[model samples]
Target: MSNTTGAERLRKRAQATALAVILSVAATSSLPSTNEGSKDMQNTGTTSPNASENLTDRQQAIVPIAAFAATGDIANLNTSLDHGLDAGITVTEAKEILVQVYAYAGFPRSLNALAELMKVLDMRKQRGIQDAAGRLPGSPIPTGDALLAAGTANQTRLSGGPVKGALLEFAPAIDVYLKTHLFGDIFERDNLDWQSRELATVSMLSALSGVDSQLQAHMRISMNVGLTANQLRQLGQVLADRVDGNVARRAQEALDRQLAIAPGP
Candidate 1:
């Protein structure tokens, strides 16, 4: 009888200890989970998806600057440059955009726009408006076969497929030049992102009269690289207000045609 009584007491004690351990574990587990949930909520509150979708202040300023640069409008370039600096765009970035303009608008316009920028900077300095000089390309450019390979990959991804057509076939050397120079050499610089480059390209094409096809194509590329249709519309408005009605009208027409062909997400 005594043995039976002692065994019953021992079992009761073990059961109580087991219950205590389970309760302790449940309590600790819930606290960390609650804390993690709170942390996630806090982090989510701090960011916005729309901010990434919309053009930044600097990008807004850049659109007009690019348009004016492509058109070789010295007076408008001066005004756009002032606005760009005020909007937090750096001197180096503005210069880079102008340099990239040569690939599309020809060297005459590019060099003239760059000279205009230098004058603007000099004038701004005389007035004591110090501007930030943005960072340059971070690494050395690739060469030879490596450059061609990288450019080919970049063109494939940006175009949503391998770039091939009759134009490239007719002049195979032009294809090599485009791949090795434009995509590989210019794009691989990495100082500017692809989206900005596309934006600048679109702006330049929009300013010119005979590049409707190129403008339409870049509108698609812009959308492919996360430029919303609405943002492109806003770009038209930028040209309208900052550039002129004629330039803005051409841009809008191009955008409308492109949208009709392939509506954006």
Candidate 2:
């Protein structure tokens, strides 16, 4: 057979396989229905999944960060990069992932996670590994009302609600911050926009052990960013097929959540 035909057949098979796996995972899991439900569930654990089964190159490349973010597993996060870096991932890209998740995950995880990334950097330098410690391509910083206005728009669009003057289940202050800080401050950074950032967040959270609700919410938000149902299904399948065992469950949970909330076609 011709190489092009082989490649075409492979792509179709991959998509089909991904769909089947995603459907299976979606069958048994569930996600919370309200913003209050999300607030009540702030699980922060980390897990490692085996990516040896049948992951593509793109999925494999992103598995580490997603797994680490999902479970907040510092040790595995470190180990994941050890593999990625050795396999030729640049330090800069790794840093960007960690830094970006701070808005979605939180300061504590983000701080600890970034610290871990820095540790990897220090080790890389000592061993002369030559991974990048370079800065982002465009270090754009948001400022003033321009920042606030954009954040407001981003938050409203992402949550499918007003997102302003909303009260938090735990801390009332955080509701404002979500609209202002997460959507406004950190999100306005140009290096990564709302869509790509949310994609990474959904993927990472889905691979986590306990953040199923958050994963589901982001999966919804992910759709708001123009991500199709099939695209999300592929993401879940990619994580399940390629990432660790725990992530398969997480990905499945996320898929179930999406299926529940997805408007009927």
List clash counts for every candidate, in order. Answer: 0, 9
Candidate 2 residue pairs in clash (backbone atoms < 3 Å): 45-71, 46-71, 46-73, 49-244, 49-245, 50-244, 51-242, 66-204, 70-208
Q: Which candidate ranks first by TM-score, i.e. highest?
A: 1
- lDDT (Cα, tens digit) per residue for candidate 1, span 106-149: 89989999999899899999999889887666557789999898
Error of model 1, residue 251, in angstroms: 1.5
Question: Number of clashing pairs, model 1?
Answer: 0
How much is 217 displaced in model 2, in angstroms?
1.7
**Tens digit of lDDT per residue, candidate 2, span 1-265?**
6989867865653343323222211111111111232212211111122233343343355556645754588887887777766654456556656766555466677778878878887887898777745334343445677666756665544555444221244455654555456666554443333434554676666654455556666666655545566666666665665566666667666667666645466
Error of 2 at 191 (Å): 1.6
Give the lDDT of residue 132 in candidate 1.
Answer: 83
Would you estimate the TM-scores of all the predictions? 0.78, 0.61
lDDT of model number 2: 0.53
lDDT for model 1, on a 0 to 1 scale?
0.67
Any runs in candidate 2 off by more than 4 Å, and if so which?
1-60, 69-72, 85-90, 101-108, 125-128, 132-140, 164-172, 193-195, 207-211, 241-243
lDDT of each: 0.67, 0.53
TM for candidate 2 is: 0.61
